[model samples]
Target: MRRDRIAAIVGIAESDIGVTPDKTVLQLQAQAAVRALTDAGLHTRDVQALFCAGAWTTWTNLMLAEYLGIQPIYTDSTNIGGSSFEAHVGHAVAGIQAGLFEVALIVYGSTQRSQRLRGKVPGEVSLTEQYEAPFGLPVPVGAYAMAAMRHMYEYGTRPEQLAEVAVAARQWAMQNPRAFARDPLSVEDVLASRMICEPLHLYDCCLVTDGGGAIVVTSERVARQCRHKPIWVLGHAETHTHHTLLSMPDVTSTGAAVTGPRAMAMAGIRHDDVDVAEIYDSFTITVIVTLEALGFCQQGEGGAFVSGGRIAPGGSFPMNTNGGGLSYCHPGMYGIFLLIEAALQLRGDAGMRQVPNAQIALVHGTGVQLSSSATVVLGRD
Candidate 1:
């Protein structure tokens, strides 16, 4: 692939996040779409392509297109769990690069918190259910816990090292007013918190919150007309290994090991070039394992790398500046918020929580407990 920027994110927004009981999933999507389009200084009529995904409905893209009242030339609703939206960014970039569309809108929303739908098992009846569901492994958390256990046994990862991930996220959340659990958190607090699945505590797990987020992508020509500086989509890749934990080739590793390097190679950059990162923190172990897979540190060194507040607000490598799914709004699918916050930092619009001189941002998303991975390298010119 050519190293030139194929597409740029022009606008980003979040709609009524954190316990939005009054809003339906579609309403939340519409709100985010409108706000994002407004932020881009564009109108609904300008959206030439539409992309969306959610747990509420399978026909999310069709419904969102109708709701937004636009007949886009291109559409996609590729749902590969929480990393769906990050993959959507890659899809939009390809469409724009191929001259299929000029303006692409990606949106996501969920009411899992309001509907009391937490801990629900995967809806389909398949081999995944037959192999893992019979043991009553708590849908996603159990899978992550098993991975954490393997990481601990193999690398000697300690409880405090895992707790450090939660504490660091909370430290960043305290600075973000929109974060759901902004209360002060510490390593001791994480350790003391009730353990949901063995090894993974309540604090280590991500919050179940109602939220919506949006991003606007366009070609370099269209980006110049938008409201904010163009956050270029320099490189991207998505891949999945398994849907069930048992099928995963290595619980201690993820597909990120493949996607991360591929994305950076495509972007023509080095690991040191990333000024900021928005890594998916579905669980503390997810961050630890992913950091290693993404080549941020040597394999199994994730524990020490994230220790001593290394990824906190003022840390050498500022990450998840919007508090991440662990502290900020998760909304079931957290990939969209990763893009939203990355764009904010690249545009220099992330107040208080901004990473100073953040020129390049790397956004990574994990789906369904180490099942899928998507990495995007973004930068501002």
Candidate 2:
């Protein structure tokens, strides 16, 4: 049986993404949800489903539904690291198609920057943590650093090549008034920045910020009456490569190797047909690996592919138009923000950072050192 062709994104909203110290995670989630509902010209009463995900926050779907004065028929609190938000879109689409519910609200919020604490271990420790954390592989930077070093050794990748990603993201951030990393950086700047890990410098990492983002999905019939033009979900696919760094087959690739072709085939589009892309950038290496996995370049050519101003603002493929997690705000898991930015660009709502005549967009999300991957193809309808 063919899956139901249901669910179109009708509205998207995000709070001021940088250093929002005053708001709690719940408040940020509520504000973003209300804004999205308002943008869709719908009342709180119209919402019938809610999906939320994050770490270090409340699992308050019912509480939020009560706060918004709506009674949701269905609720989800799935947490799959950063890719949770994007995964929710796929789940919501399936739910709607299965006649479980309609008008689902997927939201994410975090206050990582304002909260300070002594270096403490995360609440839940996986088996991988039991094995690796004992050996000083505690944080994400360290895990990705090993991957970067391997790529450099095998592919002759240069530090300058990784710096190019950060530089291009900052250039786009300069154009985005709401972007967090407004200050631009050069290759020299990146190389000179303080080292967090041996291969990954301070500039090569994503920022910690306080922010929230939300998206409203509804059946196509309802989207026709919403405030903004609907950005149809042409196709979407997801894959889990591994749960831990040690279990991965190769550090230099991602589950995108599987997800990219599956999603493109579902959308009936090719790489050349994609007009814009918003690949998640939790680390510079994430982008490089994804670029190669998604057919932007050959397996070991990501470094050369990103060189010479290819991903800059006015280049052939303008990536991370809202500055990405690199130059934009990476409030913990930043995959949701990617979907928000991509939807806005497809709707033609991005003022200055908008890509001209953009009709097709490819948005990708990565979680936990390439553990989980999701790709969505969006089209203007």
Candidate 3:
């Protein structure tokens, strides 16, 4: 028997994406919050809990509550990197189940691209920085490159396989008008693109664009009165094995190995039941490694799994239908966008790139240094 859903995403929306020089991060978040609330046919006054995560601004949840003119009874600003928003969905569900709150707003916004802060030096140096700064390993790309190198050595994963990920993401982007880089892309094109880190080319990396998104989670009873069909939160889980690349248990693996099975068990769904997926593509290697960890394919088989356009539009397994971070707008944290896309796909609201009969969606996020992961299983009734 299918487990009863305790909460559902009632509304979802994205702020002005790509480039928004005029809007502040808070403004972007507020825009998304209002739009999402409006989409739900609810107002700020109805929000009982607020959830947010962002390093661009301090006190994100507090600032958002004040900006939206709401005094939420509960607030969470969990900063587990890009996966924070996915974790928030689980948190919201727990709060609702505990009868602590009814309406929860989860929001995220970033101006990383506009402010040219994608790789800026942090004001404070940490333990990870102390060990990594001297080596000149570019914050995240270098870490991913190291993992790619290891995966290649152990699994004989080829560079072309990695390029296939970029190619497939671009193929989906071509179908999404909101995608940032929708131009025709090919495997050859990805291989020929400028190299950012070893093995990972420019095309293999996710776009650094300004974007923001929000989602409203509420009890099933409250969701029934919303503007759209409630996309039920079937299951969710998150975990992190390390805070730095140096501390990672294994470069070829991610936290998804632990979270995937747990979340799936909670949702009571098998891998074949997922109609669509929105896995974070911070880098091409990120997707390959994550898919392996998520058990979509056996370890080291991610290369073969993603090749032959298997994950592209009209393929055996449709994924990242919104173009993903590789082609879509990837602000500092891409987790919130993952949830937003999953909710849209589950709602059957995606227009040109909508996956047919997308009843169950698997949304996964990889955080900084591939150290953290969060997975959520969503379904339509």
Best by lDDT: 3
Ten consecutive residues with minimal summed lDDT in candidate 2?
116-125
Cα lDDT listed for each candidate = 0.91, 0.85, 0.91
Query: How do the predictions measure up, each by TM-score?
Result: 0.98, 0.95, 0.98
Worst 10 residues of 3 by lDDT: 120-129
Task: Please give the lDDT score at residue 69 for candidate 2.
Answer: 75
Q: Over the stretch 253-329, how does candidate 3's per-residue lDDT look in tens digits?
A: 99999989988999999999999999989999999999999999999999999999899999999998889999988
Candidate number that wins on lDDT, 2 or 3: 3
lDDT per residue as tens, model 2, 1-381: 112357789989997678888988878888999899899888678888888887654646766677667788888887767878778888888788888887989888888888752135765667556766666664788878888999999999999999999999999899899999898689999999999887999999998888999999988878889988888887788889887789989999998988888888888888988888999998888899999999989998999988899999999988999999999899988988989999999988888999998988999999987788899888886
lDDT of 2: 0.85
Q: Which sequence of candidate numbers ranks them by lDDT, best first?
A: 3, 1, 2
lDDT for residue 166 in candidate 2, whole number 0-100: 93
